[model samples]
Target: MPNETLAGLTILVVEDVTSIRSLVVKLLERLGCEAVCEAADGETAWHHLKRRKFDAVLLDFELQSDDGVSIAWRIRGDDGLINKAVPIVLLTAHDEARIVEAASKAGVDDYLVKPVMPDRLGLRIRAAIDKRQDKLDRQARSTEVSWKA
Candidate 1:
C-alpha cells in the first residue's frame, strides 16, 4: 500500500483467525495506519463498528459467529452507524461466483481471497476507499439538485 494513501486513517480489521488477523494488522502498520481496531468475531466487530467511525473496513467473509456479507448489509442499511457509507473489503478464501455476487449485493467495495496477495492489498484498500468516496460524492450532489429523480 502507498504510505500516503492510508496515513492517519482509522481502519478496522475483522477476522476470526488469530494468525490472519495479526498478519493483516502488520500490513496495516506497514501502510502507515496508526489507528487499527481489531475484532476476532462477528459480534465484536458489530460493536466496534457501531461505536466508532472507520475510514475503511477489512473483514473476513466468514466469521466464527457473524458473516461478512450480513454485516455489510447491516452497515449499509443502518443510518445511525458512525459511517454508514464506509468502504468495505471482504477478505476470504472462498472466491466462488456466488460469493462474489453476494458480496456485491451486500455492498462490498472490494473482494480479496485468502492467502491474500500482499502486493494488491494496499491497492485494493485504497481503491475501495476511493470508490466509496465517489459514491458519497454522487449522493451529495444528487441531494443538492433542485429536481428529485
Candidate 2:
C-alpha cells in the first residue's frame, strides 16, 4: 500500500484529555490523514457523527461522560444510520485480557494501549481499516451470490 493511502481519510479522535487527543491527531496527520475531528466524550462524538461522516474513530477506552465501548456499540448497531461505515479503534491505558475481551464484545475494530509508538499506531490503523474493508467486500460478494441463487 502507498504511504499516503490514508490521505483524504477523515478520522474522529474521542478522548477526554486534551493533550492526548492532540497527540493522536498529530500522529494521524503525520501518516497522511486528511482530517481529524475532536470529541471529548462519547456523547459529543455521537453528535459530531450526526453532522459529518468519518472514515474511522480513534476512541479512548474511558471518558468522563461516556465510554468508548458504548460509542462503538452504537455505531455498529445501526449501520444504516450513517452514510458511511466507520472503523472504531480503542486506545486505552490498560491492556488486560479481560479488557481486550470486553472491547471485542463491544465490536471494536482494533485495540491499542496508550503511549504507543507512531509506527505501531500507523500499522494498527492500516490493519483495522483493511480488515473492515475486507469484511465489507465479503458481504457484498455474498449478497451478489445469493441474489443469483
Measured with C-alpha atoms, the lDDT of residue 142 in candidate 2 is 80
Best-fitting candidate, measured by lDDT?
A: 1
lDDT of 2 at 26: 84
Return the TM-score for candidate 1, rounded to 2 decimals: 0.92
Positional deviation of residue 29's Cα in model 2 after best superposition, in angstroms: 1.2
RMSD of each: 2.8, 2.8
Model 1 lDDT tens row, 53-104: 9989998998988889999999999888886888999998988999999999
Per-residue lDDT over 1-149 for candidate 2, one digit per residue giving the tens place of the 0 to 100 score: 33574678898899999999989888888888989899998778888888888888889988998888888878878766572367778999999998888888887889999996788888888888888889889889888843453
TM-score against native, each model: 0.92, 0.89
Model 2 lDDT, residue 2, Cα: 36
Q: Per-residue error at 101 for model 1, in Å?
A: 0.8
Predicted structure 1: lDDT: 0.89
lDDT of each: 0.89, 0.83
Error of 2 at 114 (Å): 0.7
